[model samples]
Target: MVTRARRNETDPDLGVLAGRLLFAVQNELFTSLAKEGFDDLHPRHGAVLAYLDEGGVRATELARLSGQHKQVVGTMIDELEALGYVERKPDPADRRAKLVCPTARGLAQARAADKIMSAIQERHARRIGRDTFTMFKAALIDVTDHQRRQQPQ
Candidate 1:
């Protein structure tokens, strides 16, 4: 038999709950990043930084991957370039196209962010039990994919 939990008037909706989780995680991630000498970075910068690849990516592709507007991603690319985190170069495949490639400093920052994020996830998994946390992550991924599919193109 399926049973639903009783709802209270004060219960948070999905948007609120998701926002709370995102904000908390980003706060912790950025705090650790600042300590690692990426103090210039803001949460908005994650719209680019988090989706970067060592091989390089086009600004349009980055925008698509991060779910941000192309203009916004272009602005971010400019900021990151000024900060010495990334640079633009001609794409070998298409000389007219520019590829955003990470600088040495950017690679270091990416490594640090990966380590910090892993530590955060490990802590949470430990708190909730490994199996439960794994299940929770899988469920979250499924929910996210479903919602994305529902969105109009």
Candidate 2:
């Protein structure tokens, strides 16, 4: 159903809603992970871990994915290194650039987070009807895609 913005409303922007929803999801996942004795991991760390587990990536690429600076990403990588969660390897094409990959322990942690995310999404799906949840996801994806396409070069 189409709805109009309420008069005098202060927050009808989708960006605001997206940020709030992201925070809610992250907060839940963090709480769930913390209970399992993974309190040392952080939200940003989780993002980097997920990215690395998918495959090796340059530090700059990871920074772009995380919307953080390269220096900050490098710092986070160092922390992950200290925790034995990630390690740097030689990049095949660029010897000077390092490829980041998660350690076995990091992969395990990412997999655990995956399960937690699934459970959280399942709970969300149950709260909202299955069809409603599907439509909501599609709507969000459509908006995100459209915004990306509209960005000026």
Question: Which has the greatest TM-score?
Answer: 1
Per-residue lDDT for 1-153 in model 1, tens only? Answer: 322333322576676678889899999999999998999999888899998889999999998888788999999999999999999999999999999999999899899999999999999999999999999999998998887778788
Candidate 2 yields a Cα-based lDDT of 0.80
- lDDT value, residue 124 of candidate 2: 80
Q: List the residue pairs that clash in candidate 1.
A: none
In model 2, how large is the Cα lDDT of residue 126? 96
Q: Which consecutive 10 residues in model 2 have the weakest lDDT in total?
A: 1-10
lDDT of each: 0.90, 0.80
* After superposition, candidate 1 runs with Cα above 4 Å error: 1-10
Q: Write the per-residue lDDT of candidate 2 for residues 86-111, one digit (tens) a residue.
A: 88998889899889987887777788
TM-scores for the candidates: 0.90, 0.79
Which window of ten consecutive residues has the lowest lDDT sum in model 1?
Answer: 1-10
